[model samples]
Target: MTVDRSMIRVKAMLIAPNEDTSAHAVTLNVPTAENPEGYHRLIGGSVEFGETHREAVRREVHEELGAAVEDLELLATIENIFHIDEVLGHEIVFLYSGRLDPLPAEAGATLTESDGSVVPVVWRSVKDDADPLPLYPTGTQDWVSAALTRQRP
Candidate 1:
């Protein structure tokens, strides 16, 4: 397969056994250089030179949660057009799903950029359409819809 260089980011929707595959949602505030509220950032990153999509997903999860994924399943590949608020004009997010049954007890995860910061992780239902949800790249609606409808992973 020919890898496209245009969209250069990868992410994983780290999930656990929820209420029969309930809606899985997590919060991440993107920190501003100056802000009183203080924000959170999602778990994700760009693809490295010698990394595959699966590897990137694992790396991101470890960086964010300080845990390695023992069970990961591909849900779907959804292409999206994103108007990024952090980086370039657009990015294509490669979505993957992994199971983190017993959540890690560590206080934080390590990152090459942030030098390792502590962030909280949570699990929520994604099946509720009426409820407001927070997505990482902001263009994840298509991916979410695809994941919820696909076969059990």
Candidate 2:
């Protein structure tokens, strides 16, 4: 699995959990050959050229959820390498924990992606034992827990 330096993608994500820290908001990703059962992922997108990850997080959150990110704190940086539908992928993820200025409804709300596709932002349990669908970027479950608990590992 040799990866050229240029093939890796850089992105940022926010772990904006509810006040009680039991759950966090995520977007449902369509089922693929790699994850036939599908998965849930934190809200965010790629880090655009010339912008920092923090900027990207703010922009992504606002664009996707129509809300501002406040009290932002860097949680972790994860190197995610996987295959989606058999195509290899790699990414450098700058993860953060923050509060949404104008929070979305508890019942959930629809968000529009940069590609114009709309999806719902649903809150899911941070407890892996509780949720059926796995949260992505794989090994960051602990980071998610830190984000919800305001503790860094």
Best by lDDT: 2
Clashes of 1: 8
Kindly list the per-residue Cα lDDT of model 2 for residues 1-153, writing each as its tens digit: 333444899989988878777888888878989778788888998999999999999999999999999899888899998887778889999988898878778875878998788887888888877988888888878888876776776
Error of 1 at 93 (Å): 2.1
Alpha-carbon shift of residue 63 in model 2 (angstroms): 0.7
Which candidate gets the maximum TM-score versus the true structure?
2
Model 1 lDDT, residue 128, Cα: 38
Tell me which residue pairs clash in candidate 1.
Answer: 23-125, 23-126, 23-127, 24-126, 28-40, 29-40, 29-41, 30-40
Runs with alpha carbons beyond 4 Å of true place in candidate 2: 1-6
lDDT of 1 by residue, 43-137 (tens): 45566678887788777666655657655766555444543333343455566655553454233423333344444544444553544434555
TM-score of 1: 0.59
Write down the lDDT of every candidate, Cα atoms only: 0.50, 0.85
lDDT of 1: 0.50
lDDT of 2 at 8: 91
